[model samples]
Target: MKMRDISESQRQFALLGGIFAAALVVSLIMGWILFPSLAYARKAQPINYNPPLHVEQIGITCDTCHFFYEDGSWAGIPTLETCVDCHSDIIGASPEEEKFVNEYVKKNREVKWALYVKQPECVSFSHSSHVRMAKIACETCHGPQGHSDPKDYLANRITNYSYVVYDPRVPLNAFTIIRDKGETVWGTMRMDECTACHRSRGTSTACFICHK
Candidate 1:
């Protein structure tokens, strides 16, 4: 009778261990893999923009389109007027270029480019300070977008926030994974990265500084 009781207890222990292991595996797969995959929805740009081709081949610079206004406020994205200067006619055999000329340029309509790194309305960020005064390279925060494939961009379904790291090299697994205990792996803009960058540069982390 004692032997049977011992055998029963061991069986229960083994079953519980197996169940716990299975639950842990399921949790990790669901939280790390499944949730992230579902959290973002892929969307295409109006046109497939090749930055490196323009930059390297045509000698176009970042500020050529993304220029600063005389008032020092940054021109976040180029306007249709700016694009019209070059794209008045299709310069290349690219179907995207043709589409741009016919659909937007011909219509005199602005290309509604999706914006990444849109901060909350309460937060006031000065790109001039960071770009001009600090002399920080655009890649420092935005990643090497010049070399990135525009199609790799993804938007978070919940927040509608687009990711800046358009690199095909970086895996999307970084989208929503946490390592060890508290280390967050990320591909998109987050408050932690912002605060961390500021702290590293000895910039102000005070709420009022950003939350104007």
Candidate 2:
């Protein structure tokens, strides 16, 4: 080809490339801005809670709602004494509260809290894990519960939850994970739910990260 013609062709190609690149960058910017809002429309899998924890009223005292005992041992159960202290006062408050107190507490049995909050049976997820080791706040994933009104607690059903983990040896159903209040009973076991914070915050996860 002639030199002049070759130069013209090269210029045309460069112009086209620049235009393409500009369009690509604009598309990416638009996507980044819009994607998250669209994502909220997508149902969060694995952990599904209903009523969506709105109340701070499940009793904010660490010892009140949480089964973690003062002795550093998980009571894993709330006994009648725990209920009587407040239920005695809450008798006329509401039928639900009274039933929980008068009926269940009077039975000398604890409320059968459907524990959707769980990790793999093989994996020991201590509250101390994030609190002590990683130094991450609980609300990073659990959201704000201390301020959540008890009445607005998202009521979740204690149905089966498929447990997934880093280790294949870990039992799939090792632990029955409890969804927060208002979480759906049947949701997908998503790997992202577990890995989300780790990835976002650049936390290092070894096998001992969750599984011992």
Candidate 3:
């Protein structure tokens, strides 16, 4: 009778342990799948800038708006002067353009465009090195920007340590193989993503390579 009771207790313990393990696995799977959406906030753009029209109709390229500095850094946003050079006369007569001209250009103030891809201050990214030396296309990291319609807005969230988002637009190429559902892994300019690319390419994965 004593032996049977002991065996029954052991069996119950084993069953409970198995159930807990299964629950843990399920929780991990669900968290991995659903955490990204829960982690960030998505918002609409204040002003719409059509990339397709500029690229297709007007024959403008990415570099026309987002210029590169001489020192391998990127001038991500175009100055008001750059826009006013052509927009002074209202080429299209669109409301957005008119607003831009009247409100910003005439006022001699720069349009405060929302930045989507913001890197941390401790990191250094060289656009000219990639663009000029690597011969990497801008679309490689920025997605099909030349053809993509202006994004409604960007998603972002504040972490205790930093600001970041998991962008799904990064393409899976030879330079970057890290992917989640055919897109780059949590497409925030995280160290893991950069190190993964460097590791894959046989480049230096030094701590200071990206970090300041």
- Tens digits of per-residue lDDT for model 2 on 1-212? 65555577889999999999999998887676554233322212221211222134342454444456454456543556764666554444445666665566666665544332444466655565556567766455443434422221111224233222222232222122243211322223344565676788787656677666
Per-residue lDDT of 208 in model 3: 81
Best by TM-score: 1
lDDT of each: 0.74, 0.45, 0.63
Candidate 2 residue-wise lDDT at 205: 58
Candidate 3 lDDT over residue span 1-212, tens digit each: 45445677888999999999999998987676455545545554555777678899989888887887776678877887787778886667689877777778788887776655667788888778768877878756665555655444334456412221234365322223223422432233566667776788787878887789
- In angstroms, what RMSD does candidate 1 have relative to the true structure? 4.2
TM-scores, in order shown? 0.80, 0.46, 0.68
lDDT of 1: 0.74
lDDT of 2 at 77: 38
Best by lDDT: 1
What's model 2's lDDT at 130? 58
* Tens-digit lDDT string for candidate 1 (1-212): 35445677888999999999999999999998798888877666788878878877888778999999999999888999999989899997989889999999999998878766667677788889899999998877666666646664567788776654454554544353234112322244567877888999999899887778
Residue 25, candidate 1: alpha-carbon lDDT = 100
After TM-score superposition, what is the CA distance of residue 31 in candidate 3 from its true location, in Å?
7.2
